[model samples]
Target: MISKYQQLRAQALPHNRATLMALLKKHGIQSLSVFYSGSGSTGDTDKITATPPEAVARLADVTVSLHQAKVEVLAGVAAHALIAEKKPALEALREFTLAWVEQTHCCWANRDGGSGDVTFNVAQDTCRLKHTEYYTGSLHHEYSL
Candidate 1:
């Protein structure tokens, strides 16, 4: 049987790739690498590669699971940036995730599909999922694994 992540990836990957490309061009980023979830860096991320598309394609893959119906990039809302629409920001996030993926595997997204997660719409703006698990009953508590 196909896992939830696999199914979502099949549905989202095409749009995600398109959005990622737009973001890469917008940022003028020539190269992308990462210190992903469980990996160490050699500290060699300063070199420009001149080809992000191919580079991104060659990057690693992350298998995150989303069970909800929507997701969105958190940067715009998190940084309190003024975004007229959410699509652009979501694309930007896709680009960043691609960069991350290039360096590791499995982004480990929410399976419940919260509002702060990443979601894209073909006819409308991207949707923002919510985060409901792993709460410690604190308003602004920060925790990391």
Candidate 2:
């Protein structure tokens, strides 16, 4: 029998990216990631901007999570294929991850915040893929909270 995680993952798959962005926006989140670099000596001022096309693409492929509901999803991924061999590392990750999810979801308290989060971990030979989201808004409290 399929586990509850599998079922919820299936349901959350369709709206992963969009759902993440929506939640992030509602919580006044401006950037998904931030970075810093240093120069050896004197450095010239630099300006950074987000490209429209890139922004759209990034938004198109984000992870989704509903913290209040204790659910997480990854869109367009094959979960079973991931654990075909049941490697020790994968199994350990799975155990820790599920436990973490259980704790977070069980204690989530943003009911009226319309806040939620989701993450997607895409499998790769070298390193597994991963994405995460957190959103806050009025809807979070009304339904899933």
Candidate 3:
């Protein structure tokens, strides 16, 4: 049997892809990339770039990479707390992605640390999401009298 997470992922992937594709086409962007990085005690940072840099500017206010879209989609699904949730995966993902491209200010250290990159190739109909997380370790100290 497939897990709930897997089921939600399968349902959301196509929707997320379509959302990105539509955004790219609407902005006349042939390709786009989003870079993200964060570290402990520091904060997260992200940058969005497109084939025609000007096209990126055309996005106006709402823009997001496939990675962020998927993350939000899954999060929304999980938050519903039921498989028979009212919000469909497609609509949830579209809504989330269209609302924010990157977080205004976030501390990754709060959840450890992480970094990643996401790219969309309109011509190739390809989307790639890569991510790496950093785990924290504890240190021991001793005192002498």
Candidate 4:
């Protein structure tokens, strides 16, 4: 008896990296993950994994996510693998992360014509959007408010 989420993830298994990314974008899913598994002699036994981003997206410190330490996350990591790509799904996530970071700017109605910069680490799966301080000499500020 497969759950609905399991079915959805199963459907994604046959698709390539590009299609997975497109589905993420289409679903407005903010985050996704792709990890690898196995190092056996078969040489073809290694597997890649994909997970829902929000599964790790809350109350995260600058250094790590407590959610990632769960037993379930470690399990089933190799049960389903995606179709191989010339570029791994990790790279697809990088491109998606870059584009996702680009659209998160807010600098149109600043009285001082303020601007901002985006720093995103695909490997760390983190994004920071820092905006210039209001009426300050381009001093950047943080905090999501």
**C-alpha-based local distance difference test score of model 1:** 0.35
Misplaced by over 4 Å in model 4 are 1-108, 136-145
The candidate that wins on lDDT is 3
In the range 32-68, model 3's lDDT, one tens digit per residue, is: 7776666655433366778988876676655354422
Models 1 onward score TM values of: 0.30, 0.21, 0.52, 0.22
CA lDDT of each prediction against the hidden true structure: 0.35, 0.32, 0.56, 0.35
Q: Stretches of candidate 2 above 4 Å error?
A: 1-5, 33-145
The candidate, 3 or 4, that scores higher on lDDT is 3
What is the lDDT for 67 in model 2?
Answer: 26
Candidate 1 per-residue lDDT, tens place, 6-92, comes to: 454445544554654445454454533222122132111222222444544432242322211233558664222212223333234
Candidate 2: 10-residue stretch with minimal lDDT:
120-129
The digit string of per-residue lDDT tens for model 2 on 32-139 reads: 321111123211112211222244234333433432223335696434321212223222223333333333443222332112222321221111122232344454
lDDT for model 2, please: 0.32
The residue-level lDDT of candidate 2 at 44 comes to: 17
Winning model by TM-score: 3
Candidate with the larger lDDT of 1 and 2:
1
Residue 66 local lDDT, model 1: 22
Q: Among all windows of ten consecutive residues in candidate 3, which has the lowest summed lDDT?
A: 97-106
